[model samples]
Target: MNAVGVIVEYNPFHNGHAFHLHVAKEQANADIVIAAMSGNFLQRGEPALVSKWKRTEMALKAGADIVFELPYIFATQQADSFASGAVSILEAAGCNSLCFGSESGNIDSFYQTIGFLKNNNELFQQKVKYHIAQGNSYPRATALAFHDLTPNEDMLDLSKPNNILGYQYILSVQKQQASINVFTVSRKNADYHDAYFSSETIASATSIRKALFSENGDIFSVRQYMPETSYNSLLEYKEEYGHFHDWEQYFPLLKFRLVQTTPAQLKNIYEVEEGLENRLISTALESYTFKQFMEKLKTKRYTWTRLQRACVHILTNTTKNEMDRKVEKASYLRLLGMTTKGRVYLNKHKSQLSLPLISKLSLQQNEQIMLDIRASRIYALGTRKNQQRLLEMEFKQPPLILN
Candidate 1:
């Protein structure tokens, strides 16, 4: 049961995702393709366009042999932790290779950058500090320092979203000293930040999401970039759950949580650093809308995404102490969905799995899983769909086993 692992957040399973899956299989030449996907909430610090279960079904229907939940704590962090968590799950699941999409599309280039960073650890750190002193954001400072130190154009490209995550995936693999072979498929069509659809067969998830949630959005316009199965599933989900969500919808909850909690208490939330708790506390009172609050809180030192993640943590009452206390590695591989082949592979390799394989949520009882449940409950609340907002949906829903 040789398998290739992919870390994904098919927020809405678009054609580009389907293409990535196909390429991963071809590149790894593996019998199975397993995806460790984000559940409910996403890395961008927002609720997913659809539920994790629907995304899993889309993936399984398209090509994935198995889909595992990447756990909430790991799924919504910065790239380094996110990659580490995903890699840990795949490694534990006995995946022999890891495949990802990258802007550069060159695996050797990523390795080259990794080698330079690893070899010049001290110099890189010094340069990063120097850049920070010069008022660059941490991500910007790191990228600039890497380029200044290595003079590799590709290394500089690590600033891009996909490349940054891809670089982190390689770093995570090296950090684990795992034997997973790495591969990359070049991203196609629209860029990561592109906000509109321009092609019939390819579109960025960002673009697709923007179209889905925009007030004037025509869902049919974005449907051309999704497979029939995915698009149809999305349509059904929309019919049942209303429309996809934006963080703004949860503004009241986020604002209420922030306003009620003191700065000292806000400081306890994960990712609340550099006196950000004070800023959040102050800004939360003055700003009436989520957009205004984000604007007031955002700083050059603290990225918008980082602030959003912090707000989500605050909203969910995810304390830094709790995350710090939880084991860094993924404790379990929670199954979201699977194909027939995936079931067979799981049965054959059950004993070989490094972590507990959880097909049912009830099988695992831990703080981390509880956090995931909390996230799902919050996501359910934001759905704005009367019948579909049940928290029990997370418990009652079983893995979508596709034939």
Candidate 2:
């Protein structure tokens, strides 16, 4: 049996996601679909709208056969590292292909861009350093350097979010010299950042999340945009938990963490560089809200998104040394949930898996698992429930099995 892989957040499984899952499986002609999903924190440096377990349940109900947890270390980083970690896990799981949604739906362009970067690596590195020295953010600097080197308008589409991540996925596979066939599903209807609901059947995750948390959010209105099964699951979860988390709820804890850390200590945190710690410390002290602190810290050199991720690292005490250790030690595939078919797929491939597959809580608290637990605790802080009970859910929850 063959399986196709996807790296997803599902943040809250909606119609667009179900469409993509349908296309991925059909295009690959695979027997099963495996998803490597983000944990409590997403790539955007905010807590997921729903817990990973809830998201997993949604994915399985929608179409996915299995869900694997993408460790917090990689899930919170920028596109390249995030893709590398996700692809590594999928490859280790013995997937035959990788499928993802893209804005341009052009696979050849991604390959061309990757080839260009590899061939001009030395020059590209020099250009990136020069642009950074000139006070441009890393992402912007890289885009500027690409423009200078290739001057192709089409190639520059790599700057778009989905396309950028798609490029990274292919690049990561090449770096590992793995033979995973790649497929791109053209994105439909809503754009990635679209925050308004335009229809009932198709909308961006952003739009769904915005509506779900808005003051006027009504279940009847929100239900129209999601599959019936997904909508029901979300509705059940909301009724029990009140609502999903918003980033604002985590502000107090983040502020407290920032207040206690000195500049010297903050300097050693992962992704903290070029005196960013000073800015974080000073701004955090002066600003009371997460919004105010982010506004004060945002600049041409440091994007708001980057600053938000930095705050997450500090709140969880994730330092550069620790990040490196975790990255090096990410050798196990942690299972989150699976469908009946997914279980069969895994059992068939068990002997061929390159990494140890973890399906239950362990007695040993390793560095990587510890960081994930810490991230979960921080995410739980955003909820109104008892903190200890929320933490206990991490240990008590078993892999979701969908018949």
Q: Which model scores highest in TM-score?
A: 1
- What lDDT score belongs to each candidate, Candidate 1 first? 0.86, 0.85
Strongest candidate by lDDT: 1
- After superposition of all CA atoms, the RMSD between model 2 and the true structure is 1.9
TM-score of 1: 0.96
TM-score of each: 0.96, 0.95
Determine which window of 10 residues in candidate 2 has minimal summed lDDT: 322-331
Residue 243 accuracy (lDDT) in model 2: 71
lDDT of 2 by residue, 1-403 (tens): 9899999998788888999999999999999999999999988888888789889989999999999999987898998889989999899999999999999787877887877788899999899999999999888898878877975555637567898899889888988877799989888888788899776588888988888777897767778778888888887777666677876788888888878988899898988898888888788889877878788889999877787788889878899987783352256788999999999998889999998898876648677787888888778777775556667778888889999
Off by over 4 Å in 2: 153-156, 325-329, 363-365
lDDT per residue as tens, model 1, 1-403: 7899999999788888989999899878889999999998888888888889889989999999999999998998888889989999999999999999988898888888877777999999999999999878788898888778755565538679999999989888988898899989899877888787778689998888887767788888787899999999988888887777788888889989988998888888898887888888889889988888988888778778878888888888999877762455788889989999999999999999999887677625987798899888888888767545557778888888999
Assess candidate 2 and give its TM-score to the true structure. 0.95
Query: Poorest 10 consecutive residues of model 1 by lDDT?
Result: 150-159
Instruction: List the candidate 1 regions with Cα displacement exceeding 4 Å.
Output: 153-156, 325-327, 386-389
